[model samples]
Target: MIQPFIRVDGPAAALPEENVDTDIIYPARFLLITARLGLGPYAFHDRRFRADGTEVAEFVLNRPEWREAPILVAGANFGSGSSREQAVWALLGRGIRCVIAPSFGEIFQANCYRNGVLPITLPPAQVAALSAAAAAAHPFAVDLEAGTVTVAGRPPIPFSVDLERRLALLNGWDETATLLNAYGADIGTFEERHRRHQPWLFEGENDA
Candidate 1:
């Protein structure tokens, strides 16, 4: 679960490219694991490390200052491939509480919610400006409640998330929990009706 709202403070860097798929975020080889173990070290597998197992200094995440980036300022259409929930888990596991991009893959955004990561959307220009500002200052702030991002002591810029998604993140509710809450009364009614129509299925009512 995530706190309703918290300010994110960390160095920010830009991916500055679109269609960043799950494999790039968490490689396919790392998949097939039940527990989210040892995944953080490999997050951004291709971009952060080379095939021979050496760091790619050019990648933003490979830098020492940006490794624990609490707020990720990225390009448009981030998280654009397979709907692997592990990607979200890997990100949250790595201490990245929030992602600020112009847009996100539909399924990937939902996955973020399930794993307690908040993905925010902003204008393309705004993302570029924030990325630049973050480079100047090691730590920046992303206020989930205020829906604002402040970098380099600049004025806050507003961002938005889907209303339903925002509500889920705020309450730390996943899809199953949300559905159960929405259908609580209906489920009770159905159970009562089932007992009446099929008394044999009810433990107490079926006694001979």
Candidate 2:
């Protein structure tokens, strides 16, 4: 079962560039690995470090204070590119629980929710404000239940998520589990009807 996501409170890191594709989030080379574990160290590998194995000092994630920040405030069209689920896995592996942006790539946004990560879309101005606030070491609290993002000295910013996705996240149910929970009785009834209407289908099983 997926873990429920209700709220997250922590310092935020900023990636202000637009159209950060999946390759940048988790490079293609790392896609060979099937396991999600240990992908954290490879998240933003090229941007976070250089060929000599030295950390890039200018990258926000490389900053001493923001290294472990759990929230990310980014620019518009974040997660653009191929639909690589590993991108979300990489972020989660690195302890990022929430990403606030003006917009996100279609598949990437869905993948975020499926993986128990909150991807909040807000007005461009509001996203920029959050990015600035994070740069100054301000902490952010995101409440999925309330649909609000709160930073000190600013009014709470409201956002939207699909109702079904919100419920799934709140209940820790993946797609298959959500479907079963919602239509268990109907499924059972259908099964019984099939058994009665298609007894021949099950005849060979009894003989075996």
Candidate 3:
């Protein structure tokens, strides 16, 4: 199971470009590795490094102060491409615990929650404001329980998440765990009822 996401307090990195797909986040060349460890160095591989392997000086993540930021303030439609769980793995590998954006690809957003990354969706104006604040090298605080993003000079910004997703993140439960916790008793009762009503369905199991 992943770590629960309760609160994060740290510097924020800004990726202002829109429609950043999974391929951009964790280029397809690195997909062969099943283990999540060591994926951080390859995140944004093409955009962050030149062919000679030198870091791109202007890339937001390459900047001195933002290099280790734990929160990402991003643009609309972030994580827009293929439904690769590795994209979320790469970010988590890099220590990014939360991502704030105006919108996100549906599958990518789901994957984020499953892996303990909090993806917060706010209004466009709010996202832009947070991006600007992060660009200024300000630290931000994300409270999953409070549903607020707080920067020093601005008022706390509120964002919305589905109740189930929020609980999953707060409690560190993945999709399967969440479902089992929600319906385990009901499922067991149904199985017992079905067995009584259809004894012939179980008759061949003992005979073998």
Candidate 2 residue pairs in backbone clash: none
Each candidate structure's TM-score, on Cα atoms with residue i matched to residue i, is 0.82, 0.86, 0.87
Specify the poorest-scoring 10-residue window by lDDT in model 3: 199-208
Q: Please list the residue runs of candidate 2 whose C-alpha ends up more than 4 Å from where it truly belongs after superposition.
A: 183-208
lDDT of each: 0.78, 0.90, 0.91
- lDDT head-to-head 1 vs 2, winner: 2
Candidate 1: tens digits of C-alpha lDDT, residues 10-128: 77766777888887888888787878645677678788778899888978877777877777877788888888888888887788888888899989987777777888888888888
Cα lDDT tens digits, model 2, 135-179, are 999988999999999997678889999998898888777897767
Backbone clash count for every predicted candidate, in the order shown: 0, 0, 0
- The deviation in Å at residue 55 for candidate 1 is 1.3
Give the Å error, residue 62, model 2. 0.9
RMSD, every candidate, angstroms:
5.0, 4.4, 3.8
